[model samples]
Target chain A: SSHATGYNSNRILAPYSVYKGKAAFSLTPSLPTFTKLHSGAVVVDRRGSIMVIFMHAIGDRKYDWENRQRFALSATEVGSLLTMGPQDSCEFFHDPSIKSSNAGQVRKSLSIKPHANSNGYFMNLTVVNNLLNTKEFFSVPVTAAEFAVMKTACSFALPHIMGWDKMTHQQSTGGTVGLQS
Target chain B: SSHATGYNSNRILAPYSVYKGKAAFSLTPSLPTFTKLHSGAVVVDRRGSIMVIFMHAIGDRKYDWENRQRFALSATEVGSLLTMGPQDSCEFFHDPSIKSSNAGQVRKSLSIKPHANSNGYFMNLTVVNNLLNTKEFFSVPVTAAEFAVMKTACSFALPHIMGWDKMTHQQSTGGTVGLQS
Candidate 1:
């Protein structure tokens, strides 16, 4: 069965002597990659910083020697791929660590065409499209100066971001990811 | 103003001689070519015998100058192109001398993707994925012998076929080229 997957992240906390101690914690947060490999074609594009809730994308990635690819599909198209039938719920994945405490966060539109072949799907702690949204979250523990540098370097090296999570149960806030049998 | 367009036919015709006489004709058809000029990405396929129906895929060639090199929609994404509004009537160039009356009596499925670039989107009579369906009345006449040769040639030339159409009409049951304004 195709299941959601993710990657690892690491950061060093520099030493800054406080009056009595060094104040700080550097984020080496675990992030998710935009696309994981299956041998086909890969198209990557980054939209401006903005959040989206309009369309929902659900997927299954099973590792099999014979099968290696992700077929792009819209929500409706994915529904057709459903073998469990309508109304059935299944476990799925979503990266919520970056979700804004407020829903108004504009995560710029970022889309990628991950086909059957790819070297490796990489990810950072932020969404590639919305530099602003990524900054807002990064600035929480990191300084503006540190955020800027990290964003740029990480983006160039690891552009694809978003951890894959498993959805055990889904509530119809508007859309659902899994099919329940 | 109308000129370059292509047709995709999904039907069965009797192009064989012996039992058929005059008015029956068959022309060896070619495969269609699909490509996006900007990307230089190309794909090709083949299909059954298609009646070429038009005589002047010229003016439908949309251009103010002879220096033009391609169609506006050709090799472009459909989302960027206008949605094919309701148009039942279309125009095609007819060359009866080509004589393809009893063209393909065999079962055939023709599919054409509109030339997003050129005005006259005459389909290159190829098998492809973009095709939705086609009309019957507007087909060109071809002989049964010609149909056989055409089909065999098409099957052989599958890879060379570029998905292109010189006709510019949506297939429909209505005999009219388009609805009256």
Candidate 2:
């Protein structure tokens, strides 16, 4: 708890000056600011860095059923009003608004690593928040067309993504992924 | 903001005096303590009650790579490992550890949801995290075997669930879903 006297980019630094003392020789920066420091015995690129999340929302817990899936717990229920929620499958995507003038359209992507280990066959059909009392509502069914698009996208997809519960691969692209070694 | 100074779950209960509350229903025996909780939520079968989460470390940050992908960050550098890190595709199957005590295979089923969004063309690799540091490390070109399996599964698997992304009347299925359904 004792202060190390005058600080050098660290010590009493505002938030993340990222300075180390005589005993420490390594620095792992989570933010963009600390990338310049290289003081420690830690190997370069050896430790896993924290990823910056940009998707609007990942793995929405939505109801996959028609407009009816939102209200009741089961799809086969009374008439409903709210829209179903998103799926449990994890997703990664970029917001058009968040795009920098430099990145171009490169960052627009979504990935869902859903909890495929449960009975929520159609992840999009599974509700995350109760959704009954809020404005957040979306849906994705394993059998829905968009879901099929996602399914095909996941299956025959360029990187060959996997789906819940099976060996199925999603491939919805009209062409092939071009990459060499 | 207020408290009834008597019996509380966390604190010690009195020896003889019984504690009563305004709420009619109470924990019968008492709620079992859990170690962890998920960031998201999932509704129960029919009841308004939501399912509780305990072991959530596995799927902690699965697709949490969206924003990070903007800088074209690689998976090898990230902290903590992903399930099926950067494989062309991840194979899905039941853990096979649990036995017949469970009925629906969903309880035992497991699969990887591969990540590959090409921005609609010329997909990029190295952003996926299927299983960090394993044979699946870094993305690979989709293989012939994977291609064959996906094509067969998509083309002939479920005609009922195809070709509906850009149209109106969504695809529908009546009976239970089979392999491709």
Candidate 3:
């Protein structure tokens, strides 16, 4: 029954975009939000733009809703991360479209680096808003397990976004998205 | 010199716990924060706590600072997830210490479930604060690659947290932390 799928069953029935192939794995990292939980996904949209989508829930328990926001990264942007070193922090979202305006938001910078605290080392995400002035939003944490998934997802999604059609089942020499041999 | 390690070199030098067997992999997921980039780590601390630590940067980037936070889960908590299905939302952080108080914060429920949007399917993280009145905070998304790493990290970190000593290099029958053979 559709009811077995929980709170999101209704949304699945909606006119959401149909994705081909299968998204094999994903993880929801724990965040330090005082109120709600945060989630995300990576998909190659119909336009073939590799998008990292995030869902932020707002309002009170009485009336709750989500603000679905995302940023598209080019194939080059996603590919660069494949070679990212421990000491390196790569800024990928330089697209001016990010500044299309979410409350005077000029630039949103997303960088992935290894971070540590008194507890231990972590995979750190540093996202900052370079508006007229820089204001920080939130910093979330993911487990080492989750980080591996992210890297693999990028590798899997890369071939899709780079115009490698899998449905016809023909391999494209130009669309190999993996560790270079 | 340690200066080559970037902003976290100082933390690495501090008396923070020394982790053996090398964490090998970690990732910082892209978060939808108005201000800061959030990062996380997976480690078996000195006390053997399988901690998922997160750093949330606050204040201004000029006088910027971070609030280092984390939650520890038992081997059982980590193991239960190995079998989690698409429809399951497993609540892992039932630890009462989470209520130790960061401004009247009570039960913080951390759940992992698959979520979807007009974009595509996402590995959803639903972290809700069950305080006096329910307040929704942030729902962050992770790519499929990142999520796969999370699961593998759990498989890796679980043995360490479950009293599987590696320095001496002897396998234990009770310390298996992977899929059932």
Candidate 4:
């Protein structure tokens, strides 16, 4: 129970700092200065050195899923947001209104249309997050077609991974999942 | 390139020793004492402090996919197997012929029928590996229904995990997976 609780807490609490030279970011608004955002959940990347936190607000926990503007913030930007307080809104946009003297230095952000399905929203959020976070963005822009392909790939990979985990667990526990021993 | 190579090598080389107080096990037969067997791979469980190695023969790395008899070996049994030289064959079974007077003391093992599909085999292998490695196995037996659900959950979790990794990697490399600035 401790292990399970600990694992769950770790998953929900903050960004896992498994690798060195990376800044640790907290997802939960536990700090005194921190205020709760509209985002229901925050996802952290554990596989790589650069930690990414994807935050999106889902208005209600049950039924009526409405996604607010999603923000993909760096460690420094996150810290700034925390200090700015919850009352002040911080919007990330790729709009021309947000101008820079040098066009090359302009920051461009991606936006995903809100979906009625939670699964669709999660998948799209993941795809867009991946696209924005990748180094390839500087060289190649993610097209709508590529986004669709990535989403499809993520959808496909999900079942395989789960199936593998389930079968493995069943074997370990000596339980039959329709597989003859 | 280093990251990709490292990740691939880690996946194929040895069982991940993510927990403490568990014996480290190698899946590959790189040891001089190791004898090439018909089995394809081995899976280890971290929670129960047990290790199971499944071996299958790929033959010429092209066509032949013969499934050898699957064996689930404990840590002590694994040690004994390692001590076994290439000239000797290690046989693991729950055969009644190999009798032990004390039934309770007898080590139990699970077996799976051979599948023609490599993807199925790999998925099963991964599932079993994770099941054996988790902390929950010490307390609860994973049920067939639970296994199905867990597999489904894992399936969904995989793409998110992979997508996060890809994004993190791209960000680290400063390459675009296609977000315009």
lDDT score, candidate 3, position A168: 30
Residues B1-181 of candidate 3: C-alpha lDDT, one tens digit per residue: 7788775566432112211121111222111112211222122233344454333223332211132334455554565554344454456544344446554354444555565542211322223445546543323344445556566665555434433222111111122211122
TM-score of chain A of each: 0.18, 0.20, 0.48, 0.20
State each model's CA lDDT, in order: 0.24, 0.22, 0.38, 0.28
Q: If both were scored by lDDT, which would come out higher, candidate 1 or candidate 3?
A: 3
Docking quality (DockQ) for each candidate: 0.01, 0.01, 0.02, 0.03
Prediction 2 global C-alpha lDDT: 0.22
Q: Which sections of candidate 2 miss by over 4 Å?
A: A1-181, B1-86, B95-146, B149-153, B160-181
Interface RMSD of each: 25.6, 24.3, 20.7, 18.0
Best by DockQ: 4
Query: Tens-digit lDDT track for model 2 on B23-105?
Result: 01111111112221142211111111111111111242332223221111111111011112343233222222246443232
* lDDT tens per residue, model 1, B1-181: 1233324344334432211221122232333433323333222322212322222123443222232111111111111111122221122222222344533322222222333443222222221121334332212233334434443543332212212121101111122212221
Residue-pair clash count for candidate 3? 39
Clashes of each: 103, 52, 39, 26
Residue-level lDDT of model 2, residues A44-130, one tens digit each, is 122112221111122343222222221111111101101223344443333333455534332333223333553222222222222
Expressed as tens digits, the lDDT of each residue in A1-181 for candidate 1 is: 1111111011111111001011111211122212223553221222111111111112332122232111122233223222322122232223332456544443322122212232111111223223343421110122222322222222321211221111111133226434365
Q: Model 4: runs farther than 4 Å from truth?
A: A1-114, A117-119, A122-152, A155-181, B1-11, B14-104, B107-137, B140-181
What's each prediction's TM-score? 0.18, 0.17, 0.31, 0.19
Worst 10 residues of 3 chain A by lDDT: A11-20
Interface quality of candidate 2 as DockQ? 0.01
- Top candidate by TM-score: 3
